[model samples]
Structures are given as C-alpha cells and as structure tokens.
Target chain A: MNLAFAEIQETIRMVQMESLDIRTVTMGINLRDCADSDFEKMNTRVFEKITSYAAKLKETAEQVEKEYGIPIINKRISITPIAEILGNATVEQAVELAKTLDRAAKELGVDFIGGYSALVHKGITKGDQTLLDALPEALSTTERVCASISVATTRTGINMDAVRQMGEIIKKASELTKDRNGIACAKLVVFCNPVEDNPFMAGAFHGSGEGEAVINVGVSGPGVVLNALKRHPDADLGQVADVIKKTAFKITRAGELLGRIVAERLEVPFGIMDLSLAPTNAMNDSVAEILEEIGLERVGTHGTIAALALMNDAVKKGGAMASSYVGGLSGAFIPVSEDNGMIRGIMDDALTLSKLEAMTCVCSVGLDMIALTGEVSAATLSAMIADEAAIGMINKKTTAVRVIPVPGKKEGEMVEFGGLLGRAPVMGVNPFSSDRFVSRGGRIPAPLQSLIN
Target chain B: MSQKRAVVSVIGKDQVGIIAKVTTILADNHINVLDISQTILQDFFTMMMLVDVSELEDLEELQTAFDKVSNELGLKINIQLEEIFQSMHRV
Candidate 1:
C-alpha cells in the first residue's frame, strides 16, 4: 500500500540493465509415502505423485514471470531423499528409482530433480549403503537426476567411512561421464549439516520433517548489489555494507512476492525464500567481482575473506528483514564455474584451491563447482571433504563440497559444463596425498560447540 | 477490495509524443492512469505510470500493445505488477 512512485523506475532499471532475477522456484515434494515393497510399483507411485503435484509448476512460474515481469530462471523439483524410502533396496533398484525420477522430471518439464540422496552423518543404514553403492551409475545414466549425501554434522561429528566412500563415488561418476567433461559429478554434492529445504540444485531435497508438498524460492542478484556499490564508490566500508543490505532487501522482497503468488496458484504451502547471491556465467553477474568492487584488487588476495564476510553478513541481514521466512544456505555463493569473475580470478592466478577453501569459511556453500586434476587421489578428495566438514561443524553453518575430477583433464585446461552450470579452468590441488589419514575410517568426534545444549 | 495496479515504465532517447502515444495505447486497453511522472536527463527520457489495470481483460494483449509502442518508438517498456515494487522497496 505504501509503494513510492519514485522507486518504480529505479526498480525497472535494476531488472532491465542490472541482471536481477529470481534464480529458481523449486517445488519440494515429499515422496516418502510413495514407497512400496514392489520396486516397480514404488517407481510408478513416485512418478505419479511428482507429476501430479508439480504438473502446473512450469506453467504457473511462467505465468507469474509474465505477470510480474521478473525472470523465473529455473523451475525445478526436489524430493524426499530416495535412501529414506529404499530400505533393503538393491543397487539395480536404486538405479531404476533414479531413472524414474529423471523421467518424471522430464515429463513435468523440470530441468533438475534432486534428492537421489542419503543422510548418513552418524551411521549408514542399509538403504543408505545401497544407495551410495549405486550412486555413481544412477547419476551417470540419468540425465536430470542429482544426488547429495550428508556425512557430517556438528552434533554427531564427521563420518570418515562415508567421506572416504564418497571420494570413490565421485571418481566413478566422473569416469562414467568423461565424454561430457565429467558432468555427472557436477550433479552430486557432499555436505556437512545439509539444510532441510534448500531450493538450490545438487543440494535441494524435501526434508523428512517437511509436509506433503511445498514451494521454496531462491533469489539471486549479485549485479544488483554491484550496481548499489558502484553508486557509492567513495563510501566507507560501513556505508558499503549499508548499500548492500538495502539492495538485498529489495531483491528479497521481490522474491517473496513471486514465491507467495506461485505457491498460491499451485495450492502448495510456501516454504522459504533463499536470498543467496547466486551468479551465472554472464558478465556483471559475478560474486567475485562484487568482492573486488569492495576495495580488493583480486578475489583471493589479502582482505578478500574480510570483504566476503561483510558482504555475506549484509546480504543475510537485508534479506532477513524483507522476508518473513528466510532459510536455506542464504548468503553469497562463490562457485567458480558458475561465476565468470571466479573463473577470471583463477585464470589470472589470483585464486587457488587453498584460498577457495579458506573463503568457504565465510560464504554460504563450500568448494562448489570446482574441478581438480584427473590424477588427484580419492583419499585427497576425502581429505578435502573432511576439511570443509570440519569448518562447517565447528562454526555450526551449512557447508558442502561439489568438486569434480575431470578425467584426462589437468590444470590450465577449460571444462565446459554449458548452460547455468557454466565452465571452469581446472585448478590444481596439493601434490601431497592424505591417503594414510583418510584410510583411518573412523568418526571424528563432535567439537565442544556440539555441547551447547 | 484491494486495488489492482501496475507500474508501466519507459526509457529511451528523448523524443516527441512519447506520453501521448503511451497514453493512447493505455486508453485503448481501457486502462486508467492513476498517476504519472516524466523527466529528461541529458537527452534521455524516462517515464513511470501507475495505472489501474483492474479492467484489463487480457494481460498478453496489453503486453503486445506496449511492445508495439516500444518497437515503433525505440524504447524499452515494462509493465510490472504494483506489488513487486511495494514488496521490494517498502517495509
């Protein structure tokens, strides 16, 4: 009711020229009830439930986009983690289930369907073990299915067994799709303390605690924030933070409005609006560039973490103010492949794997969309996952790893994932191996932070 | 009842008859202009019109109508629901 007339043109300019967008409107549909002892029946039930529930998802999103004049970039679906429903499932049955999910997603016009996943942070169940065993093949054969695993949490600590196995799983998945630059690994993420209702792909899933079906929205606008910063180039850090907060507020508001309308139209409960500053490969839509605009010459140079932390905090504060429900990994996403500036940072030797690991401590997600040399050992991958998990567990924040080891690819070579997945130059990992350490497959006990209760 | 309104924004090089042409199209679609403002900054023109689209029978038609004006005048015109601006910039 209090919309100012003066703000109209500015908002339009943000959309038209600054690349502001509702990054994704993901429908999280619980598939737990679709399970059955008969695998074929179970698959059919899963397909029917998803197709019926999300039949109108793309149409409604397009209608909303046309009505509001805001681009709803991706309309996707997340389901209840398949492992939870596939107890006593065989490896072949698990693969079939993944294919079912992929087929259902394609039928519903959804780009990606997540939750081909398992949660084994504390211990692996029979279903989780089977799903993990089949994950590599399941992901390679399916075109639209994504898989995620949670192997650590603050309360229970890191599960070294699952961590070590994921290293091998990623290797096999990468080998299976070596023809496509190991794109299969791009659809998989390993997490410590994964969120219940994230709307972002390769990580989103319908948490067991969620209701029958829900709609979650992810809003992204690094360009909007950059434009705000450019307006006050002479402003101090405090003023810079203020500008980012204000810009985030406006972006989150638009996302919330779009989410509510889409949910209402679909007759699904509105989940949460994730206000992460996700970037694409396009120019001027990069989070690393936003960091550089904040007085840093290079993204991985000194003071980069401090600048990133400030921007992440400001984005959350501003986004939290705009939406009543703010959840998911709501901060700045620094995926190297998905963001052009991050790619440039690597190409210029301004960023490295070690520095990216350090930056994950302050950002939303961890070590996302990073490709390493083909010869990097599985134990090293496990060690990397352990490091990121330790950061998340100690800080009690959500952190994940989506690293791909492209076969026959080395540093200084480009791997093109195409579309929103973008492309990246293979970054070198440390030459030293963590084999002996990773081979000790035992739990890393929870830190003192877990004793908060 | 809540009023259904939309903000129709236009931006391009400064030219004659912009307002007249835009208003004529809105009138053709039975849209009533609630408020409007225009300004010129260094040969560039920008205009914002808050109009009641409650009587709008077809959103697609209205969009095509605006597209026709935009194509003919070499301007970028956008029609967005008022709730978007209210939710974004306002508390």
Candidate 2:
C-alpha cells in the first residue's frame, strides 16, 4: 500500500495530538466446557482455560503496539456468561465463582474480565436468579470483574421484574461499597437488547453463539472527529456528517487491522470491531466535545440530540464502509463521568439527568457512568431502567444503564472513581416514587418495531 | 505484494541536519528509504520518510538509534510500521 505522505502525517497527527487509539482488544473465551457438578472443579477448569488461552495476550498486544506505534490502551478478556455455568448455585457459590474470574483476570494481567452476567429479558431461570441475587456481593468483592443483566430485548420486550430487582441490586452494591464512594455500582450494568460481542465493559460477554475463542477490538477517536470538525467550522450540517463519516472510516480501518493482528498472533478467530467514540477523562477526547464542535453551546442543550443523531449515524455509515463485519454498540458514547465536556456541562447546570436520558435516544449507550443522589428510591431507579429499556426495545437499538447511587452523597457532591472511570457529580433525581408502576411485575410487550420479522 | 515498510516522521522547528541525521540512522540499519518528503509549515518543519525495513532484523535496535538522534536533535521523531498508515488511510 503506497500511502501518501499527507495521509501518513494525518494518521500520526491523529495519534500524537488527537488521542486516537485502540481503546480495547478483548479476547472472548468460551467457558461452557468448564462447567461441572462440583463448583471447585469448575473453578479449576475455568482458571486453566483462561490462563492458557490468554497467556500471551498482554505480551502480544505490547509487541504489536511497539511495532506499529499504536496505543492499545486495554487488554481484556470476556468469557461466556457465568450464570450459564453456575446452574443451581447458591449466592455464596456464585460470589466465589466471580472471585475466581477476578483472580484469573489479575493473574493474566488483563484490565477487566466481563461475563458475570445473566440474560433475563424473557424470564429469569434458576441460574439467572441466583446470579442476580449474588450480583451485589460478587461486584463488591471483586476488583476487575464486571456484571451485566439484560432485562429487555427486541423480541422478548422489557422484563419489569428484573428491572425492579436490579434497582435494589444497584442500591445494595452502592451501600456495600459505600466507603469507596459506591464504586461497585460502576461495575454493574442493566441492559436492554444487549449485544454479545461487545468489547467494551461493563457489558461485554462472549455470548452463547461465539466460537471457543475470538478477539474483538473497540476503537476510540472522538478527538479526531472534533478536530476534523474544527477544521471546517463553516461547513453545513450535511458536510459535517461527511467529515465524521470519513474520520470514522479511518478509525474503524485501524481498529480492524489491530484486531486482526492480535487475533492472528493468538491464533484465534477475528471478531467484530466496535466503532464507538468512547471518551476518556482526558481533555479534548470526549464525545461531548464533538457535540459542542457541531455548534451546540452546551452538550445537553435543545439541538444536542439532533447533533448526536447525525454524528452517530455518520459514524456507523463510515465504519460500515471500511469494515465488512462491524458489530457491537457502534456509535457515540455519552458517559458523563468519563467525558470532561459532559462533566463540565453538568457542573455548569447545562446537563441534567432528564436531558441525558433524552440524549440517549440518539446515542449508543444509555445513562452510562452517571451518578445519582443516594436518596433516589429503588423504585425510581427501576423506573429509569424501564424507561431506557423501552427506548431500546421500541427503537431496536442497544441501551444500558450504569448509574451509580453514591451512598450518603447528595446532589452537587462528586464521586471520584479515578482513572478512566473518572469522577462524576451526583446529579439530582426526581423525588416522586414509581413504586406502584414497577411493582406491577410482568414483561412489557415488544413494540411494533419488533414485528419486522 | 506489499513490501514490509516503515514510516519515519520528524517534526520540530526548522533547523539544520534534521533529514541528514534521521536518514543516517536509517542507512546504518540497512533499511532502504522508498520515499521522502518534507515541508516547512511556517517555521515548524515536518518530514515523512517511507522506508523498506525488510532487511532490518531487530526493530528495537533501530528504535533505540532513532531515540538517540531524537534526543540530540531535540525533535519529536516517530517510526511506525507502514501497515498502520496503509490501514488507516487506504481501503
């Protein structure tokens, strides 16, 4: 490939100045064969399988990084959902399994290990119920383990019972980790129409249909898009979309190459690339900044949703043009704590929880990394999940809730999670209770969009 | 076939011996320069070199040599494998 010098300079500038990097290269390891009647035996098998499969993950990723000069920020592992392996397990046993997964992650030197999860969109099985009951203990006791529960799907609709249960779980998780500013809640996510091949946490899992092992890459480059937009400040909205699409294509192509290299070295199958504009706390590298680049005075203002819709759609279009197999929640992520612009928007009173919810209608992830008041009732939290699930279920998009209820913290207080998780200001929540609505336990039927099949 | 190539980029204030010093390091390592271009963007000099590194066995050694030159010249020098550029910019 005889790439032009200008193109080479542009790619270098994107990396050196614009924070373009491979956000994650998550290896999906299927642990279905590790299940056994004895939990101890199963744990041993799980450890052996993971350590053997990912033994060279960190080293290979570093080698590739040094060779290509591309920063691969995270090396992670996503296993098959633990609930599938823990059939009829007690809550104590489930927590022990979560610890095993955590130990494997620590030993392998990966950042995070996902798949402490249960799918209850249709209904909760025995294994799903046990995992749900033990989510608080599991999350609080582990450092690197992430837990997700899919409470709604396009076909099965919303499971209000699971949604209601999740609210209590989130509260308990926050309370258990209260000393750490309710950080355990950051590891748990409530999802609607969750994808199986997502490389990003806290919602990634190996999925039932995946092979024995696969490698998925998540690409992040919001700063590149913002810089491109700044170069053409006078361009109209249509031209703005064109710029975003081109930038996203480049980002996706780089991500696909990285994923292929990692997978080839590990001798694993190459999985999909997630083209999400995942933001870090770093200045200028934020999805919210990209929104502001589109001429919005603030990220949560009146025209924010329309701006986000254009950006998200253009990103998908561009990524599709570059890669043959693009999957996961591939769009702009608006996680409040992880985005400096979003945090500033909230601090300036320009962004609020309700406005964030409205913005999620056009974005990829929903209510991500948001902090809420401790006094927010479990019923209200459940109602928030239900509303987000309704949006995902009706619109046929992936949406999730990773809201943290910082215990003993009121509005205007900040919850510092440190590092890439970042710090979040505790935003005010609606005081009115939704106890009666959530108490009516049943599934919300799928909408008309689900009838396309 | 796409030959294995590397791109050596240098950027800093326009000064003497920027290209000479970088190309010398490349030449000593048995790496062949395929294409070279430089432009001064209002006193900030930028040069990009596409070099074939098929003969170079140890990548780290070349990197260390470049690092030394970067320190001596006080310029930001980066050597990236060409696949990164090709993949990012080409279909």
Candidate 3:
C-alpha cells in the first residue's frame, strides 16, 4: 500500500472516535464599501454585499466536507467591524444595521455572523460609543449576530471606561435575555489584543488591514491530543510534549489543506489557519482532559497552569511547522462551558474564576464562556476584565472574557446555553468590591514592553 | 485532467464476498482500483483500496452505494480523498 496501515488507521480513529473536526471556516468580507450616509441605503448595501459574497460559502463548505470525509462544523462570516462604518449613525440605526447583518447571516445559512465589533483600546469615538450603546439591544434582538469589543492592547493600554461600560452592557443584555439564561452574552466577547483573522466567533472580525475577502480556518482536535496522550501512559513530560507536537502537526496539515481547497473553490485568498485546540461539549474532547491526562488529577487544581503552558507551547511548535501562515489565537482554549471536563471541575469545586483567570495567562483565550451570579456587581465584572486585559497586555498575547451572568442564577447552579455554548455551573466571584477602582474611569497606561522599537 | 484518487477502507468481522461486494460497486462507478491490501487481525478483517476516481462524478452517489453495501455486508466502509491522508502523514 502507498500509505502505511497505521497512518490510515490513525486518521480514521481521529475522525470517527476522537472528535477531530474543523471548528470553523470563517470568510472575512470587507464591508467598508457598503458604507453610506443614508441608513436605509447603508443597510441595503451591507446586506447585498454580504449575501453576494457569501452566497456560496455554505455550499462550498458542504462540498469540501463531503470530499474530504471530514466535518466542517461551522460555516461563518466576519465583516468589517460595524463600528467602522457606523460613522454618524445613532444607536437605533446601529441596532437596525445589526438586524440587517443578522438577516444576511440567515440568508447565507450561517449560524453566526461576527464583526459587530468596536475597537476602543485607546479611546472611544462617536461610532464606537454608538455601537457600545446598541450592543445590549442588537445582541438581544438578533439571533445569529456575534459582537466583540477590543478594550485593551499591548501597544495601547486598557480602556477602563469602556470596560466599565461593557460590564453594565453585559448586565443589561443578561436581563434582556433573562428567559434564555443570558444567551445573548454568550454571543458577545470583550477582547484584549484581539486578532483580525481569528476564525472563531464572538471574537472574529476582518480588520482594516485585511483584504476584500479572505478565508480563515480554525482546527479543533483536543480529543485527538487526549487520545494520543492516553496511548503513552509512561512517557515523561518531555516525551509527552513530543506526542502533542506530532499530533498537532497532523491536525494543522489537515486544516490547511481544507482551508486552501475552500479558498481556491471560492476564488479568494487563503488568509490563515488558527490552530487553536478549541474544545467542545462532547466527551473525550476537552483541553482540560488533555491537561488531566498529563497527570493533573483535575483542571484548575495546582500545577494546571504548568501543564497548560506546556501543552499550549507544544501545540504551537507542532502547528507552526505544519502551516506556513498560522495566526489568530493559535493555542489551547479553556472555555469552561464549552468543555465538559471544565464543567465537571466547576461542579467539583476544583475550578474557580480565579483559577481560570490564571489559566488564561498561559492559554490562548481568557475567562471564556464562564457563568457568574446575577447579583455580582458590574464593578466586579469590569474588574475581571481589567485583570484579564492586564495579563494579555503584559504578556503580549490575545485574551478575552465572554462571561454570561444568568439572571436569578447563583454559584453552584447550572445555566444551560445549549449547543456549542454548552452549560456551565455559575461560579462564585470575589464578594469584595472594586467599585472605587473601576469607577475611576481612565486608561491604564501601556506596559513598558510596548516601548520596543 | 490528473487522476483524482481516493482511499476506500472496509473493516468488519471476517466474512464472505467482502472484496467482491465492494469492488462491484467501484467497477460500476468506473473507478479504477490501483492497489489493494488486506489483513485479518484476530477475527476482524481490514482492507484498504487505493482507487483512481478521475472519471467518476457525484462522490455522494458513490458513497451512498458503498453505504448500502456496508449495511448489507455488516461492514464499515468509508471513501475519502487520498490527499487527506497524504497531507497529514507526509511532510
């Protein structure tokens, strides 16, 4: 046989048994051309442009999935951040534009349409303020629209004013969607050092520097990594890292091939492949499980940070060698609700908000998909965002917070968002207040590392 | 056009006419079987066939035919483009 038996069998096992699959193939379409002074004309242009460009996205992804015999789980679209073209629109017009985006997403048959975003790392413009004001309404009213705000970056300090506003916006969104356990907040993310080409939703947007249209793919294979580690029980930590690297190489190669084919068929440039080990709600498909397989009894316990740091580095090392262009948040993800092992850890009291915050320092993203109590003050939420932004700013890595404060839910209780958002136990936050600190609204100065020439 | 190749794999309890059944479908679809390898590990029969699908259209149709054969013969049959394996296993 041209291919070794073990190689063929390994691929089969990875797909069939382990939950190896492409998480998303996001097409970033520049909507700057769709901008117009007239609100109705702008909406029409935006809708038409997205529909025309992404009309074949779903069909092409399905065709590729059938041909490769691998699942492309999500076909999504990311546009130029809405705030960019909002110009002088009012908050009501911004919400209407979000509805148009939601309509475009539905027309294209994509589950989520990202880029309802605003970048306010340094300061907020009129458009940014309008979008921020419209978020609570736009997110609650729209089904498929995902929003993100970049509140901090290494080059520009954390925007404390925006962070404080976001905390209140999150609370209002939760209250608006109180019936659905704050599902709207699940569709919103606050980012620090956000990537323009990230294929994952709620944090994905086509930056100003991106092309007219590009294809970015996110590959997921925590189960594949977990199974590889399981096969080598006695290997030392160094050898274990080797196993993860080899597995990641294979996963990234498959992702690049798939992304390139999709891009070619669509006749667009292949942007990048985000080799994030994004976990799902499925059993045996958890990044926490990989950490535990590395000898941690439970995630969020002591030594979890070291284990995650090792796994994240090895994945990057392996994936970097396989793909020529690796960008976005390309490391391990530790979203509690989306990962079953993490949900279990939360239920067992082994995982807490503090531990997850620490884990974010080493992992790809931060404090992702966690649920907190409704009574938790907006000040506390803002403080949480500040802490995470600090980590991302100082370390010069991307981090984000996508916490859902389920109304009427408290710690140790479960809030179910269903589907990929999964269900997470409401985690306890510090009862102490950071009201005075966050209330003093001003930008935290950029770290000295940003002074690099 | 260059040859479009695929790998068809079948695994199940050792049984009769497994090769005949799978090859019959391939032959009907005008797919050329370039190579074949089979082995019985314990009581399970595992077979792999590399075939050229250049002339074939509608891969889903061929997959459906294989699925029917799979259900009838009590074996698991999967047909995937050969490039998937090569890209992952090779440099």
**lDDT (0 to 1) per candidate:** 0.92, 0.91, 0.93
Judging by TM-score against the true structure, name the best candidate: 3
After TM-score superposition, what is the CA distance of residue A357 in candidate 3 from its true location, in Å? 0.7
**Error of model 3, residue A206, in angstroms:** 0.5
Candidate 1 backbone collisions, by pair: none
Question: Just chain B of model 3: what TM-score?
Answer: 0.95
lDDT of 1 by residue, B1-91 (tens): 6678988888999888999999999898778998888888688898888899886643677888889989999998888888888887767
Q: Quote fnat for model 2.
A: 0.71
Off by over 4 Å in 1: A1-5, A450-453
Retained true contacts (fraction), each candidate: 0.71, 0.71, 0.74
C-alpha TM-score for every candidate: 0.98, 0.97, 0.98
> A175, model 2: CA deviation in Å?
0.3
Worst 10 residues of 3 chain A by lDDT: A444-453
**DockQ (C-alpha) of model 1?**
0.65
For residue A197, give model 3's deviation from the true position in Å.
0.5
**What does candidate 1's lDDT look like per residue over A1-453, in tens digits?**
246656887788788889999999999999888888888889899999999999999999999998899999999999999999997779999998999999999999989999999999999999999999999999999999989999999999999999999999998999999999889999999999999999999899999999999999999999999988999989999999999999999999999999999999999999999999998887899999999999988888889999999999999999999999999999999999999889988999989888999999999989999988888888989999999999999989989999999999998999998888999999888898899999999999988954565
